[model samples]
Target: FGDGSFTGKGLYHVDAFEAALKNRIDENTILSHDLLEGALSRAALVTDVELVEDYPTRYSVDASRHHRWARGDWQLLGYIFDPRGVPALSRWKMVDNLRRSVTPIFWVLACVAGWTLLPFTQAAQWQALMILSLFMAPTFDIVNGILPKSGDQTPRGHFSALARDTVFGTALVALKVLLMAHLAWMMGDAIIRTIYRLFVSRQNLLEWRTASQAAKGGNDLGAYYGMMYGAVIIGVVGLAIPVLADSTGAFVAFFFAIFWI
Candidate 1:
């Protein structure tokens, strides 16, 4: 559903109350509800209204919900790509949702590809690539550091300050990434399963979980591993493949697999 309505903060968090049921919405699904609502409302009023949700307490529960959401978002591919009479804005909304759902899949694929090609790359090439990647993560910070303090349009010495800031920023980024390791694994888990159900197994595309269903007894590593076994397998193999390679591919893939553990 294409519309100009502004959904506050998050579409799931807040939106208009009034809604109309159409005979058929070209774009439809659990994830597309807000977009469809916005499309039908035709510029509904927006107030500084706060909506609160009694979300589940368990992290696994939350992950389960998002996993379902990932499927719902991927289901919109047909509507997004089809040349239908749907509004352009609606198509774009679907595209955005699809992009979010598909990014993790692409990330995992790239990881696999990187590992597969690692054996062919020279040691110098792989080493340089690794160094360049680390530096590129803080490219913006490096660029900002080029300019000294205000009114100090003076020439910087050999970009020393910029280089220093880049290294520090990259370290901070690496730390932040490590902290969110669990989240990254969960996201990848959701999308991979979404794709499997959507195209591989061709089941559970519309299956959703209630709060009660999502609730877990407690945190159990074995049970956790059961649900996230795919990520685990990928992580183990991803690391093994790089280490097995002769080049410095291990350095390139270490960060990718390290957080999974």
Candidate 2:
């Protein structure tokens, strides 16, 4: 009973794991924990496995690791859907696995889109709902952090870290979503082609890439903070403009400006 780092002998019993790898056709394709988990689930071996908490102490390393994981997940989408390689799982299981893999991308998109559209729509119901949802999300995370048996111990700098993560993490995710969306819009074909080569064409998928330069060694710290602070300002101004000036156009313009940053 263990997480993806399971090095014990029990893993050898999961025939689907080896089958998935062999079916890949390309021997050099990089393997990921998600792929193994999906394979195990598809083969009905999930119940036999156990998971444990493994948290990273360094934020920079964790960010880099997550970036690699996201890329691996995107790449796995191609293999899972391809008829040639991955062993066929039940339709329901396959769909569920795919959904789980892309959950993060969907979440970021939803947050960005919701915030961007909120001003223009001026829907009070939606505004209330968004506020409640955002508040609940972070509150839940904070509660989870302090809960007994949770992976993350209460940090020594608990309040500061919690506040920083809540604000910076939201800003960072918004920026990432906007960047990815812009790239997709501007270089849709090129991006698609690259994915095809890496996954479908059996090109090597083991390259390491940094997710954000700003996250590395506090490089360009000023610029990063400037952007984050700017986002906060824009969000505040966007909401305030509508109430104070009673101008929908002003509210929308400021809201849209947030994405431009």
Candidate 3:
């Protein structure tokens, strides 16, 4: 704490001195002078430097009590710490963290199950079902991530801002996914080449490629290729099975695709 008395004394002196100085000072500049004096008092409240084992280092003054009195100016610090003085990463943020963790699981499971189950119900619905399921994964992922937890308490203003950001962010993600899927549909080989490019860009994939190349170059290409190929395989198989099934055969095919396959 700025020598507890110094902060108060400084403010008092500033007000008194400024009141005397005001007669000679232009009224238009009084606000600027008041701000300067307030800053000086704030500085006096804490020593210019604190010594730890006699080594001088800049220090922060305890301003929790004064922060509430700072009006609109101090509200900015609320971004750093809430009214509880706990930062955003604190355990008190349980609701936000819980929602973040649960969203991915919920969306992944829903899309996986839907793809695995829905296709066999109607053979004619193969194209619609596969494409819907393929797109649903990313769509649901983005939606759940952006959606506010019904039970969570958040500042109304912050939540509104977050909703606005989510709108634009989700649109961008959807656009990317659409373009990728379109390119994949138009040219199957392009997807594999794009995977190579993706492998180069993503550090994890690059490491996987290096390890695989070291282990057995060209020998286990099938296994190495299958890593990125799984998603496309799932989608293509989902699309193909319905084509092979008869009108009523799709019922059994759906069960095989979802549960057995």
Deviation in Å, model 2, residue 78 alpha carbon: 3.8
Q: Write the per-residue lDDT of candidate 3 for residues 1-261, one digit (tens) a residue.
A: 222222222325657666644544223312112333333232344446553433212111111111112221211222224323322333223334234323433433343444444554443365344445445555665567565666565678547856766676657554433333222222333223334433354222212122323334333546433333533554446435544443353453444334312
User: Candidate 2 residues 1-261, lDDT tens each?
Assistant: 222322222444447566655544445464344444444433233466676855655444454455455445455555566645344553334456446445444443444444445554654344345445545555667667553454475655666666776786577545454443222222333235447857477664665644445255554656444433534453455445455655443444454445634
Winner of 1 and 3 under lDDT: 1
Best by lDDT: 1
- Against the reference, the lDDT scores of all candidates come to 0.59, 0.48, 0.37
What lDDT tens digits, residue by residue, belong to model 1 across residues 1-261?
333654433433233443243444532233435554455544445467677778777767877777666666666565567624556787777678667655555545555556556553553364345345545547866776666765655456536666678768878656544423344466666667766765678665557677787674447888766666666666777677767764465666676676665
Pairs of colliding residues, candidate 3: 2-45, 2-46, 120-254
lDDT of 1 at 256: 64
Error of 3 at 220 (Å): 20
Query: lDDT (0-100) at residue 78 of candidate 1?
Result: 56
Among the numbered candidates, top TM-score falls to: 1
Number of clashing residue pairs in every model?
2, 0, 3
